[model samples]
Target: MNPYLIVPLLALFLNLSLFTYVLALKGKHRVVHLYLLYAGDLSLWIISIVLYWSFLPIHWMPWIFKISSISWLLAGTLFLEFVFAFLSKNPNILLYLLRGLALAIFPITLTTDWIIGGVERKYWGDMLLPGPLYVYGVNVLIVTPAVYAIFLLLYESRKEEIGFRKQCYLLAFGTFLTSILGFLTTILPRILSQGDLHYPPLSGSASVIQSLCVFIAIAKYGFLEIRLEKIALQLYSKLREGVILLSTADELLYWNESAKEILGFSKSSSAPEKLDLGNFLDGFTRKPFTRMDFKKKSESPAKEIRIDDETIYSTGPVYLEVSKSEIPISGRDLGKVYVLRDITEKKEASEKINMLYSRVVRDLDIAREVQNTITTRTFPDSEKFKIFSYFRPYDHVGGDVLNCAESVDGKIEILFADVSGHGISSAMVAAMASISFNVVSRKGSKPKEGLLFTNDLLSSVVTQHFISAMYLRFDPKTLILEYSYAGHHAGLLLRKGETLDLPGKGGVLLAVGTPILEDYQIQLQAGDRILLYSDGLFEVRGSKGIPMGNTTLVEAVKKLSYQDSDGLIRSLVSYSESFGDGIMTDDLTLFCLEISESA
Candidate 1:
């Protein structure tokens, strides 16, 4: 083998390698395909040069020279196509026309002597003799298009982003170098010397420099889809979540800064290149990182682990949410990506919130117990009259209070009050109202007088809330009933299947204003029932979003007039609950008084 033949042979090998590598890439895009076309042409040009120098036979020289001519002629058009594809630009008409010209001139070189002309045996090797149109062909077909492609790349690089622009500049510089070296070593010698060149053409060997430059651009600055991979890696490195990539053999391929920080790896030290998954996770945990059992499972849920190493976490124990997912390619398991999220703050905050919530719940339970003791759970019943009361608070504590007591004169005093709202504050107001009622009831005040006294006390003490109340007094022997209201809903009097509203004379809410109440008297016949209730029952909304107003409640009470006092209150509560889908928007209170038939 001649020493000079080694250069073209090596160049041929490099071109073939570049072509094969690009073709073998998975999911090859348009730019890659165009590059493959360019590379294939370049390889052909080098192959023809190698064959021409081999001196195969006297007759084969013309054919090899013709092949070399065709390849070199098409090189510029193919490279321009690749440039356009790389820049993501649509080719102009000029590109199409130049491609057509190259194709049209290719057959001319192969079938006729217009372009290749003839071959001459030189001291170094066989060289192609230039035809009459060879100069025009070389300039028009090869030099012009290659120069234009490099110019376009340089012009477009300025508008690109910093990273991509670097790639474009590198590519342009490589192509320029290839063009300059190829022209000087091959075309210049051939045209200047005609057919009697003393030295062998080194254009094929010179192409290796361009291929090396392209490879450098691909490896360092990232060209084509490799640039996308570089971008992904940069983003992955910046993630707050720790990410670790492992090969199928459990070798550590990649890990981000966050992964190092999470695993408590020394920040100053570099990662070991040959570390396995087990060694990577060794010092991070004591239990073999959940025994690496998650890798065995096809679908694994995120696992929370507590790191109690005081040396790593100075504040306290660190909580991490670790998850693993298999990275598969083309139905084959490539590796696994382990993600670690620092959930220490979230975990601690959640625990603190739960503690506060538990304390509130316990306090509310105690408040409900105290309110239950203060509010009346049972009402006094007698042969002459039967009393029934029901109360349901919207929350753990209620604003509604119902109480019944016998005065010094033996008159049964009943008071039912609803504060402005439900919950702890309102329940406290209800308790105050209960105490006020008890104090006035012991003094044996009249129905109107009792409300006035209760209002006076509440108005002076409570500022944020008010109370609506009804006070009633009954004489068992006389069968007479006296009632007064303070900004409360009208009580219903059920008599002989007729419902009548027992409206108050001066209805003013307590605690907000002075009470000016008037007591009303009604003669109660045997079996007559009076119903007193808070606004919560009628204020509820049904499924159609319509409120169960006072009119609907009065009609419902009239329908259930035949039932006894307890049964009537129970049925009414059930009706309201059913209408509102068992959702209580406010505190509910019901007090029913019935005169027995025997009375």
Candidate 2:
């Protein structure tokens, strides 16, 4: 076989491969029009190769070669068609009719021998050679559209987003050189009569270069867009994020692209063992990130990432939201992509905000200590009454306070008050309420008189206002229970299996109305329990606009019949939790007292 047969065979394969690739990218790149252009060019080369290779069998070689010249016109026309498609240029019906007229000239020349030389059987072989006028006629047909296509490509390249157009220019230049050289190789020798001016030097070299370019463009280069894999490689070299990508089972694959560049590894080399993705990432001894909090296949809000001195502040999806895609060549699940973006500045800002919060918390701690000193825990105990108290605050400062003191006359006064609101202001009111209880009780005042006096004192002294309270005094010898309410929720008394609700029917809260309270007396038994609590306990909102009212309290107390004071209080909280579906909106303070036998 002639060595020249290699060029045509390579061109045939190049054209076929590109055509198939265009089909493969069918809906994706919309490159079907490119396929038609290359196919026509391949038909031209095939006919030319066969005519030259089998010149000795001249029975049909001349006719076939003559016919093959028309294929170049089709190829050139489609190249222009693709150029217009790329430039987003739409032509009218008249312009397309003019193109059809240009294409007809190729067919007319082929049949008439105006496009190629006459057939001759010389000593070399039977060669349907080109005539003197062949080069001039062929140039006119091929050069017009090919030159126009080049102009269109160059014009489009000047536009803003002309990445694909720029590539098209490279492609057109390669094909243009090959096609012009191919025509010259066939016609130049017959016209000059001195030497063949095309093949070997011009056409052969151009064909080889064109074939290599088409192979590269179709196989390696993406559809004119930069792919994520390429971007990943660039970030690996440039950014500071210590990215270590892992498979779903946590097997490491890729690591710091930046680290490798820093350590002097070429972009093509793998990461070093010391910097191997798995070993290096595992050596990062900080607390592991919580996977539960991460969104799957979605982005995250800005968050802090402190990885050693690097401090990669991530603002986007910390991991690549990779969906599974099947590689057509390999029927396997390719691993997911994990993209990480650094937001170091935003992370530092958050750290500063947290530091400021810590400073404020420290100041609040000092205030809490001073508040504790204002209220002493040395209240006198009573033998006739056993007190069980539970105080819990949602915040640093609670709104609930309870005080009990023994009088000189063997009477015991118990006071429970829930200050208005919560936090710092409420803590101050609680301190005042405790101080007032101690002073009034030391003055030997009765429960009603003491409460009225305390209310009056606070109303005048305190800035923003009043307090709700229930004050009670029990005398063992007289067997009388005296209690008064000042704008507070009533107390609950449990005797045997029955429960009683004590209504406040008296004065308003402190600082609001006159210091007058109704006094209620009830006989107590040894086994009876009385529970005092803030409105936080029963005034909780329940279903259908009803508060957990008196009726619910009665049922709760009866259910805790066998329990002691502490146990009964726990049961009430548990039952109330069940009543409100485990969500309580206010602070709960319960003080339980059991009636005991006189010593």
lDDT by residue (1-599, candidate 1, tens digit) is: 75668888888888787767556653357777778778888888887877777767879888778766778888888888888877767899989998899989988888888887888877566888888888788888778888998889889766444446667888888878887987887678766776446677666567788888777665544466544344465688899888876655554556778887777676766665444444433234323242232121122244343222212112245556667777642123355677877655444434432333343345776567647855677767689888878888888888898888887777898888888888987876776677667667887778888888767656655678887788888988898888888888788888888888886666665644676778889899998888888888888899999998988988888888777777888998998989889887899888888888889
> What TM-scores do the predictions have?
0.45, 0.39
Steric overlap count per candidate = 0, 7
Model 1, C-alpha of 11: deviation from truth (Å): 1.0
- Give the winner by lDDT: 1
Query: Which consecutive 10 residues in model 2 have the weakest lDDT in total?
Result: 322-331
lDDT by residue (tens digit), candidate 2, 1-599: 56655656676666665556555454344334554564557556565654556555666766766676666545555656666665556754533753685577666666676555556654333455655556565555455656777777777655312223435656677767776776566545656763233333233224545555654544433332222143444466465543444333333334566444333456677433222222322222223332212222233466665422444344543322112222211112233333333332323334432432343345667436534543334544556667777666547766677777778887777888888787766766676666667667776656677777666556655657578888888786666788888777778887776777765556656655576677778888876778887767766666665678756776777777677777888888887777777666566788777777552
lDDT of each: 0.73, 0.58
Q: Show where candidate 1 strays beyond 4 Å.
A: 23-27, 159-163, 189-196, 222-225, 228-393, 396-599
Deviation in Å, model 1, residue 166 alpha carbon:
3.7
Question: What lDDT score goes with residue 329 in model 2?
Answer: 13
Q: Can you give the lDDT of residue 59 in candidate 1?
A: 92
Scored against the true structure, residue 310 in model 2 reaches a CA lDDT of 43
Q: Model 2's lDDT to the true fold?
A: 0.58
